[model samples]
Target chain A: DAGVTQSPTHLIKTRGQQVTLRCSPKSGHDTVSWYQQALGQGPQFIFQYYEEEERQRGNFPDRFSGHQFPNYSSELNVNALLLGDSALYLCASSFTVQGYQETQYFGPGTRLLVL
Target chain B: AQTVTQSQPEMSVQEAETVTLSCTYDTSESNYYLFWYKQPPSRQMILVIRQEAYKQQNATENRFSVNFQKAAKSFSLKISDSQLGDTAMYFCALKRSSRALNFGKGTSLLVTP
Candidate 1:
C-alpha cells in the first residue's frame, strides 16, 4: 500500500501571495492533520480534519485553514502569507477507531519558502 | 492543551553505542498518549515508539524503548545499538482526546562511526 503522499515537494512564493498544499492520506485511513515546522523547531499543529469537517485546530490564525475531501485527502491553505509563513508543511494521517489508540503516520512534507 | 519538553538540544553516540533522550510533559488530562517521532533529512516524521498513559509497563519496539514515569510526567527514549541511520531530529509529543499533538522542541541525535 502507498503511504501518505504530499504534492509540490517544494514551493516558493512572495509575501501576500496565497498557497495551497495537498496531501493524500494513506490507504484505508480517514483522518488528516497538518503541521508547520520552522527551521530547527518541532512541528506546530495547524489543524485536523475528519469526516470532511474540521475536528480540531491549534493556535494558528484564520489565514490558515484546511479541508478534508470525501476520499480522506486534505488541503492546507494560507492566504495573504507573510515571510514568517516560510516553513516545512507536514501532513499526517491516522486511522480513527473508538477505544483504540491512534498512531499517526506522516508523509515527506512540502517545503514552502515565502520570500 | 498539553506541553511537551525535550531538554537535550543535541546528543551524540558512537555507532553500536546507546543514547537516551529526555522528555517531560505537562497535562491535566488523565487520558493521553505519548510518542517519539524521528525525522531524518527525508523530512517524514516516523513513529519510533509510543506509550499510553494508563499502561504501567514501558513500551518497546526493537532497539527503541521508552521509560515512562507517569508520576513524574517523564518519558525518555533509549536507543540501543545505535547505527549511523539513527541520526535524526527526535521529537517528543503528547496527545489528548482532541487527537492534535503538542510537540517539543526536539533533540538532534548524531550517531557516528
Candidate 2:
C-alpha cells in the first residue's frame, strides 16, 4: 500500500507568483493536513481537510488555502508568494480524527524556493 | 491554543549507545495525545511513538520508548542501541481531543558510527 504522495518534489517561483502543490492521501486515509517547514525549524500547521471541507486552520494568512477532493487528495495553493514563503511544504494523511494512534503519516514534501 | 516545545536544537549519540530527547507541551484540555515523529533526510515524517494522556503506562515501541509524565506535561523519547540509520530530526507533537497536532521546533539527532 502506498503512503501519502506529493507531486513536484521541488519547485522554484518568483515573488508574487502563485503555485499549487498536490498531495494524495494514503490508502484508507480520510483526513489531509498541510504544513510549512522553514529551514532549521519545525513544521507549522497550515490547515486540515476532512470530508471535502476545511476542518481546521493555523496561523497562515489568506494567501494560503487548500482543498480536499472526494477521493481525499488535497491541493495547497499559495497566492502572492513572498521570499519568506520558500520552505518545505509537507502533506500528512491520517485515517480519521479518531483513527488509531492519532498518528499522521507524512509525505516527502515539496521544497518550494521563492526568489 | 496548544503548544509544543523542544529545548534541544541538536543531539548526538555514538552508535550502539542510547539517547533521550526532551519534549514539553501546554494545553488547557486534560485529555489529549502526544507523539514523536522522525523526519529523515528524505523528509518523510514517520510516527515513532505516541501516548494518550489518560494512559499512565508509558508507550513503547521496539527500540523506542516514551517517558510520559502527565502531571508535568513532559514526554521524552529514548532510543536504545542507536544506529547510524537512526539519525534524523525528531519532533514532539501534541493534539488535543478532536484537534490537529502542534509540533515542536524539532531536535536533530546525529548517531555517529
Candidate 3:
C-alpha cells in the first residue's frame, strides 16, 4: 500500500558531472513519468515509461534519459549536467485502465543541485 | 502543443475562508482532462481534484471543487474552509487522452489565521 518512492532525496553535483536518480512506482501501477521542477515553477514533463519502454518524451535534451525496469521502477540519468539542471526531480506513477481515473500519483521528489 | 496558464502568482485568504484559483488551457481535443495538484513544502505533488472535459457536472472532493468550463477552456479550483495546512503551490494541469500532463507555472496559495 505504499505510494511512489524515490531515492537520494537530495543530491549535490557539479557541472559536467553525471547523476542517476531512482524511482519505484506504487504497487499495481504500470506507468512511470519524470518531471523537472525549477525553483518557483511548476514541473515540466521529461518522459514517460511503460512496459520497460519509453512511450513519450518532452522537450528535454539528449543529456537527459531514463529507463524502466520490469518491476515498474525507473531511473533518470543526466549527463554533463549544467547549473540550470538544478531542480526538483519528480517521479509519478499511474495505473492505466480504460475508464479509471488515470491520476498520476507522485513521489516526494529528488532535489538535484548542480554547482 | 498545449499551454496551461495560471495568472495568479500568489494569493492569501483567512482561515475558514474560501479561495478560488484560476486556470486556463488551450487544446482542441474535445475529450481531455484537467487537474489541480497541490505541492506543500514537503514537495509531494498531491492530486486535489480532477475534471474530465466531457463531464459538464464538474468534480468535487470534500472542500475542493472545480468550476470547469469546457467551451472557455477554463478550469478553476475553489478551496473551502481553508486551513493553514492548505498553504502551498497549486498547479493546473491538462492532459489530452493519454499523453503527458501540461502544467501551468502554478499559484502559490497562503491560508492565514
Candidate 4:
C-alpha cells in the first residue's frame, strides 16, 4: 500500500517559465488536491481535481491549473512563474465517499524554486 | 470564506512533558471538520488528529488529543509525554462539505531532551 507519491523532489525555474509537478495519489483514492506552502507558512489550497475535472479552486489565479488522470494521478502546472512562486508544492489524496470527514494523506511534496 | 488561525508561532517543551497548541477558526457552516497536521523537517504532512463539528467528544490519537469547543470555535492539540520526534510544524485546518481545507499559519513545536 503505497502512499501518495510526487515526482521531481525539487525543481528550479525562472520568471516567465512554466513548470509541471506530478503526483500519484494513494492507492484506492480518487480525489487529488494541490497546495502551496511558502516559507514559514502553512499550505494554501491551489485547486482540487475529481472525476478528471476541476471541482473546486482557491484564491489562486488562472495561471495555476491541474489535471486528474483516469488512474487518479495528478499534475499541477504553474505558468509564468514569479519569484514568489518559490515554495513547497504538496499533493494530498482522499476518497470522496467519506467527503469532508475523509482523512487526506499527503506526499513528501515538491520544492519549487522560482528565480 | 472560512479561516483558521494559530496565534502561537512557536513553542517549546521538555521531553516527557506535555504541551498544548492553540487554534481558532471562523466559519458560518454549522457542520464541518477540523484537523491538525504535523509537518516535520522532512516536509511531509502527517495527520495528527481530527474532530467533527457535530461530535461532542474530542478526537484523540495515541499521545495526541484535541479540545474542540464548537461555540468558541476553538481547537487545541495536547501532546503528552512528548518526545524529540514530536517536534514539528503543526497546522490547524478546517473543511466544509467538498471544499478544500483552509489551514492556519501553523505553530512550530520544539521538544528538547
Cα displacement (angstroms), candidate 2, residue B65, comes to: 0.3
Over A31-113, each residue of candidate 2 has an lDDT whose tens digit, in order, gives: 99999999988899999999999989989999999999999999999999999999999999987645432468899999999
TM-score of chain A of each: 0.97, 0.95, 0.96, 0.96
Which tens-of-lDDT digit does each residue in B1-113 have in candidate 4? 44898999999999999999999999989978999999999999999998989999999999999999999999999999999999999999998877889999999999999
The Cα RMSD across the true interface for model 3 is 2.3
Local error of candidate 2 at residue A56 (angstroms): 0.7
* DockQ for each numbered candidate: 0.70, 0.65, 0.68, 0.77
Give the per-residue lDDT digits (tens) of candidate 3, residues B1-113. 44999999999999999999999999978888899999998899999998888888989999999999888889999999999999999999999888999999999999899
Lowest lDDT 10-mer window, candidate 4 chain A?
A: A95-104
lDDT head-to-head 2 vs 3, winner: 3
- Model 2: clashing residue pairs? none
Off by over 4 Å in 3: A98-101
Q: Which residue pairs overlap in candidate 3's backbone? A: none
Model 3 TM-score, all chains together: 0.97
Judged by lDDT against the true structure, how good is candidate 1?
A: 0.93
Among residues 3 or more apart in sequence or in different chains, the pairs in candidate 4 whose N, CA or C atoms overlap within 3 Å are: none
The models' CA-based lDDT, in order, is 0.93, 0.92, 0.94, 0.93
| Poorest stretch of ten by lDDT in candidate 4 chain B | B1-10
Q: Given candidate 4, what's the lDDT at residue A76?
A: 98
Best by DockQ: 4
By DockQ, highest first, what's the ranking?
Answer: 4, 1, 3, 2
